[model samples]
Target: MMSKLLKNRYLILRRIVQITILALYFGANAYGWKVLVGNLSYSKFLQAIPLADPFTVLQMLAAGAVVGVDVLVGAVVIAVFYGLIGGRAFCSWVCPINMVTDLANWLRRKLKIDRDARRINISRRFRYWALGTLLVVSFVVGAAAYEFVNPIGFFVRGLLFSIGFGWTLILAIFLFDLLILKHGWCGYICPVGATYSLIGSKSLIRVEHNHLNCTNCGNCKEVCPEKQVLNPVIYRKSGFINGIECTNCGRCIEVCNDNALKFSIRSFLKNN
Candidate 1:
């Protein structure tokens, strides 16, 4: 049990972060708690500092909205924070949708769905295209178009505010990842994730690889959501997992019994 807990420490920590954020949101709404107010798109931290999602702000900008100074500050705060840390960390650590999709992924593994089912070969680059298309649509529609159908927004809002078909959208994503594609919504389609990936491309914190320690057991690749990022380092070379697509979820690090992978600060002087 101790060994199991140690192995899954990162996963457990991520869940705690994810759940704690949601609980704070729920508390703010239901009990008027001021610890963290507002939704993920925009929020006032501790009723003083503003925190905003930069991607949402971008959509507002694309839609020709007059974004307020505070909101802009909040967006900058978030962008800078993620730019220094891991950008898509939001997808794994803060997004409520992550729980649903993760459950679907777990079910996929438990049910042997990954082995028995036909795999889909969607290019990961499709997310970047989706991000671009969303901006274009936001410009043309005079609104943040993606916001209407965003599962993250829906799940968070539905949890704290109202249910109103949000569960259906969440369920669809769950099924999509479970049945259609592995890591489908997050890996292949979320423009929000795409935006974060771009912002955190040069983040300091990264999973570093020590090829000398690797056993080539493939445990890390089996659990990594972005396994392609490991290709250069898992068995081939020693360096930071530099792919912007990496969420820095630390699953690869946690699962590696060989100690080949661990989190480290990226070296600016060295080519990663």
Candidate 2:
């Protein structure tokens, strides 16, 4: 178990970050800590700084609503963050829904189910389409239409407030990951993730593959949730993992016993 934990060091670190952030929200609510309050869409930190999701802000704009300065500042802060790191990093490191999907994926493997057989056919553009549709709906309805169905919001509310249809939405996601698709929610359908990916498509920081040390053992691929993002970087002499799909979760680096992969700036990537 110790050896296994060491090998999955990044994965463990991701869980800790995700749990800690959520715990702080609960802390604010249940204990009146007030360090951080509100959901992912909006948050107040230390009763001073406000944080808001850019996508949510866009929805509000489409609805022709007023955005406060604090909310705008918070959105910029988040944008700068995901812009520097990878945007999809939010999916792997911050979103609470990732834990549910990941758990279903793990259980699917443990049950000896053939993943390829259960996986459904879906275009990657579905997320972009979903994103466009959401904006249109928000414009038409003069409200954040997608917020009504967003599972991330549901998960946070369900956790801190009361259980309602949120549990059903979450359970449906778990079943979808296990029975219909390998990465159905975040990969193919999440508008929030799609929006962030666009924001960080040219992120400076990325995982660099040390082609000199690689043995093509394929452990990295086996552990990677976004396998296609690694293909060019690993095999085709690409500069870095340039795809917006990459979350910088570092699972590839973690499972590589040979130290063939590590985080570095895109400019520092070695050519084959």
For every model shown, the clashing-pair count is 0, 0
How do the residues 68-169 of candidate 2 rate in per-residue lDDT, one tens digit apiece? 898889888888888876557888999999999889877777775553564567887899999998999999999988898889999998889986867899
List residue ranges in candidate 2 displaced over 4 A: 115-119, 268-272
Which candidate number has the best TM-score? 1
TM-score, predicted candidate 1 vs. hidden true structure: 0.97
lDDT of 1 by residue, 176-249 (tens): 99999998988889989999999988888899999899899999889888877888777888889998888989
lDDT of each: 0.89, 0.83
Q: List the residue pairs that clash in candidate 2.
A: none
Measured by TM-score, how close is model 2 to the native structure? Answer: 0.93
* Top candidate (lDDT): 1
